[model samples]
Target chain A: MHSKKVRIITVFAAFTCLLWIFGLGWTVKDYLIGAAHSAYSPPAADESAAQTNELKIIALGDSLTRGTGDIEGKGYVGYVTDQLKKEGLDVSLINLGIKGLTSERLAEQIKEKEIKRQIGQGDIILMTIGGNDLFLGGQTLTNITDDSISKLEEAYLSHLKAILADIRAVNTEATIYLLGLYDPFNEFPEGALTSKTVRGWNSKTMELLAEDSKAVFVPTYDLFQLNVNDYLFTDHFHPNEVGYRLMADRVAALITSGGGPR
Target chain B: MINLVQNEMTKLLGKRRFIIISVIILVLLSMFTYAQARQAETIKERLGTVDWRTELQQKIVDWQNRLSSAGQWREQLQIQIEQSQYYLDHDINPSEPGAPTFIRGFVENSAELFLPLLIMIIAVDLVSSERSMGTIKLLLTRPVSRFHILLSKYIALILSVSLVIFIFGLLSYIISAFMFGNQGWAAPVLTGFKVEGGELNISEVRLVSQWQYIIQQFGLAWFISLVVGTLSFMLSILMRSSAAGMGTMLACLIAGAILSNMVSSWTSAKYLFMVNLGLMNYVSGTAPPIEGMTLGFSLAVLAAWMLGSLVVSFAVFMRKDIY
Candidate 1:
């Protein structure tokens, strides 16, 4: 019986050994010979096939949209989703927010095939950009001047216009919520100057969004203007959890009050 | 020679090591399948949709968000982001939903460390145990030459190595198929992605069926296991205590795993057998532990190690003084 069992096992092992050797040889041949398999070409984008009943929220922009400063890591976007869920709405969210993303980068990012497809499927598109472009990581404060600020504004406006156009190209029905920047430096020594610059920036943005009927300019300046220090995070630039809550409450209110695509 | 090998096979089967190895694989596969299922569930719950493209996009964005704080890993993350973007652009799901996909991933991950350790469990004591048990006297007294006896044992070791891999593949397939379902065998998988100078080079990228990719992956994995088995075989001949042999092989494997992560600056370390054991990485297009380690280069290095160990094992076993 032992001999019979060993014989069977040996044959099985021998067969597997040969199999692996063939697999090994085939690998070498395939990798080295450079087989000319045709390159994969993706199918054309079918925009209408992805329709669903769930409220798909696609969040795009910088660290603010990414919940960078909020201790719970739920930025305004998270809170907005939470509130909507509380209202008994089925929601799915895709946050494509990269930290320190400028308007230019966001413009380029939205042009990706997957991002475009995601935007086409979204019911609500939330964005927070121009922070890095305007603040330049707090570098603009050192060289605060009308010429520099306007130069930054000119570049930003063009990029923002391009971004809005690109987004509209793929998704015309999704209501875009462009959150206006809050002046984090409102409590600084140059508080008055920074606040004036930020207000100017926000007004310019609002003017651009005015052209799009579905686009809503959510004002966050007033929210942070009063309790600037209390709302600011440790970096004194981004908003804390409570500050994010304040912003979320405003957006959630707009979204619930017929701001969303019904 | 055939009878000698059959004799070794009887002894090997008598040890029931294959049964132990299969049990180990079964236990590990169950844990992995459960973990994978849970992960898919969490992703579904969070996304509220089962669209793979959206999930992949979210992963890319999450990686991008970490780029700022990922001081040392920025370049690696960048490459990964670009590779993922390439997959998204080509509309090829990097991981399709099925047992084959699970097997592909499992094989790639285990090829480097886990599979090799399993090979060692069978090989580490193949000859050392004979010495420890004083069976060398009876075995050597046979009319067969010392070279034939050793060669038969080596052949048996090779056969067992192949069998262990087969068992591993079979058990993982059965368990994961039950968990993930049997599908995606014909799914298109993108391969031949090349990383150079911290950039993803897609010029050589092409599509192969998932089954073909898995076969090629298993081939490379088999080569890796064989190489590891040969080294352990050499140690078995060189050492008297199986425990010491196992310990030495285990330490080397763990060191290889660690060194592959941080040995980018140590270029000379690329020649080491442990470092070259990640043969699957070259096929899957992950950046090598050291720069300039190509598929051909790794294959050559591994083959050289295997041949060198074979030469050492045969020479030592044939002429070494027996107590």
Candidate 2:
């Protein structure tokens, strides 16, 4: 029995040895020559047929959209989804918000194939952009000149226009809630100037979104206008949980009351 | 020669090492499969859909978010993001959901350290155990020359390494298939993503079927395991105590794992056998642990080491005085 077992094992081992040698030889040949293996033509996009009965919410843009300052890590997007779920609405969210993103970057990001596909599948879209473009990570705070502010706003408005056009090209039906910028520096000594700049920035953005009938400019200026310090995180740039909750409450109220395809 | 190898095989079978190795593989594979299932569950719960494209997109975004804070890993993460975006553009699921995909990932991850350690379990004591039990004397006393005896033992070790790899593949397939199902053998896999100067160069990128990719991966894995086994065989010949041989090999392997993570600045360390063991990285298009390391370079280094160890093993075993 021992001899027979050894014979069986030896034969099995020898067979595997041959198999591995073949595999090894194939690897060497493939790596060295890399002969034109038939190029694979990808299958056509299947129109994303798996649309379930849930409200698909796609959140896009910068750190604010990413919930950078919220201790709970749920930015306004998360709060919006949670509130919708609380009201017996089924919602699925894909937050594609990266920190420090600018309007120009968002214009580039929405052109990506997968991002376009995702936007095409959403029922609602929430976005926060232009913060990095306008603030320049607080650099513009010290150099608050009219020339620099208009220069930033001019480039930003063009990028925002292109971004909205790209989103509408793929997904015309989704209600786009473009959250306007608020003055995070409302408590600073130059609070009046910064608030004026922020308000101008918001109006220009609101004007651009007004071209698209389905787009709504959700004002966040008033939310931070009164108690800027209370809503600001320690870094004094992004919103805390309470601030995000306030933002969520406004968007969630709009989403719940708006009449659209379920 | 065949009879000598058969004799060695019989001794190996009697030792019941294969049973132990199988048990170890089974336990590890079960844990991996469970963890994989839990991850899939979480992704589904988070996304509310099983669509792989959405998941891939989310992963890319997450990696991008991490790039700002990734410090030294920024370049690697950037390359990975580009590769992932390439897959997303081509509409090819990089990791198709099935047993074959599981095996491909498992083999790639284990080829560097885990599989080699398994090979060590058999190899570190191959000759040392015989010396410890005083069977070497009886073996040398045979009509067979010492060269033939050692050659037979080395051949047996090769056979055993091949068998262990086969068992690993088979067991992982069965276990993961039970959980993920046995599909996706024909899924398209993108390869040949070359990274030069921290930039992803896609000039030679091509798509191969998933089965071909898995086979090539296992091929590289087998070569890595064989190199590790050869070194252990040398240690088994050089050391008097099997425990000492095992301890030395374990330290070298763990050191290699840690070194590969931090050795980019120490470029010369790439010549070491431990650092070159991640041959799968070249095939998977991951940046090598050090610059200038390629498939050809790693293969040559490993082959040279295996040859050097074989020569040393034979020279020591041939002339050593037996007690």
Candidate 3:
């Protein structure tokens, strides 16, 4: 009986061994085949730029641009797109926002091999970025450049420029509207130091707008600043329904005016 | 006495159970490690292909911009963006999931579900079996006293239970190393991930060493299993019939385990032996469960219960009218 039990145990052990071996081998093969396929046929960017349309818009940068955390939590993209439809404007927003992305991260995404092929001439590029970078004390330099509030601002802009250059590399004739960083700090009445950093950041944003008139600067600073208590939420940051509506109105007015492609 | 335990240990050193359990663990570890290695290699192959993060973020923001923002709510999104930004700045992706968490160690984690049955198989009929065959009465009639006979069997039971726990833990340790890699040995465990509104929040804490972690994890399982085995041994003595003892203990063990998860709201249920099954964590330096009976408290409760059963067994075995 003991010998019989031993034989049974041994068989069970051998069977388990065989199962693991074949299963491991299969896993390796699946990964190898997937790797080979990706290499053999690289995923290319979409070539159809919707040339039949009178206007083409690309929404770029982080979650805010992605329009995920709005009041409906569907975000600003659908609302803005629907509002655009309200006035017969041929438009489509090419969404390219990566969550947990700073300006540098966005720059990295912009340089993706597939995205380069998709951006085209005469496209309208709308972007909301740099808020994440600024909030994280993204200041790379210890000394503030009068040109920028903190030395890191210099580094941050270079990253932004790299992102811009990447887009321009693909579509030079596209009109890019850079939304100036709003005073999310305005709600923080007691946060004088943080507000200074916010003021300094906003200053640099305006200066960049002056530098490129062809690039329209949509001022969101005032939209979120007024009735700061009423517009702000319990978190004392971001926008409520009133604030998002103001944002939609600002963007709609610009596109309705047919802001020319720079 | 220690040497006797050690000698019994050597008897099990090359036993089939030891060899079989170890190899099973090693093979599992190797397979998981190899698969992960291959998958990571593929990810590296297409490292520069797609910027999934930006694409995801863009989707979030497009949704953010379109939705009609309501009252005092924008502040929360601001915090989300800021918190999301922190992860971005650090290049950390907390959402990437794999492997059971550290507290829930591989071997012992499954042990709760299956280890109890294995223990019952070996230990249920331990003392009762000798009596069932009338061999125990023959031994008692010999020159040796009843205490010595009982003590020997008890020691043997302890040794066997310890070996099983060690083997179970050893298998998990070696296998996880293969599945997760050496890096995973040091991989951060989000001990208790806090999820709100379908989002996982990462808190600040240092990672514990893998080996030390395994020791603590095994320690907990052994303690719990020891409690379980001890209870079965006590039951084995009280009941003259091995089948009766094993069946009753098995039902109680199963019922205890099932009740802990199902009727969690019952405050009185905390005293149940099954609820204290996580005695593994107690010995390993973790905080007690919500309003849990403490380690000292639980050990005392189990000890009293065991001592009480042993008292009843000694009295009945020494003087009971057995046919």
Best by lDDT: 2
Tens digits of lDDT, candidate 3, A157-237 = 888778777777778677777776666565444445555666677777667656555567777777766676666545555
Name model 1 segments beyond 4 Å from true: A43-51
Calculate each model's fnat, 2 decimals: 0.78, 0.81, 0.03
lDDT of all predictions, in order shown?
A: 0.91, 0.93, 0.55
DockQ for all candidate structures vs. native: 0.74, 0.81, 0.04
For model 3 chain B, the run of ten residues with the poorest summed lDDT: B187-196
Give per-residue lDDT, candidate 1, residue B25: 93
What TM-score does each model's chain B reach against the true chain B? 0.99, 0.99, 0.62
Candidate maximizing DockQ: 2
List clashing residue pairs in candidate 1: none
Model 3 misses residue A164 by how many Å?
16
Query: Please, what are the lDDT tens digits per residue for candidate 3 over residues B210-262?
Result: 44444445544555565677778777877778789778877887786677545
State how far residue B236 of model 2 sits from its true place (Å).
Answer: 0.7
TM-score of each: 0.98, 0.99, 0.44
User: What's the lDDT for residue B183 in model 1?
Assistant: 92
lDDT tens digits, residue span B263-295, model 1: 999999999999988888777887888888888
Model 3 CA deviation exceeding 4 Å by range: A1-262, B1-104, B178-208, B240-244, B280-292, B320-323
Chain A TM-score relative to the true structure, per candidate? 0.96, 0.96, 0.72
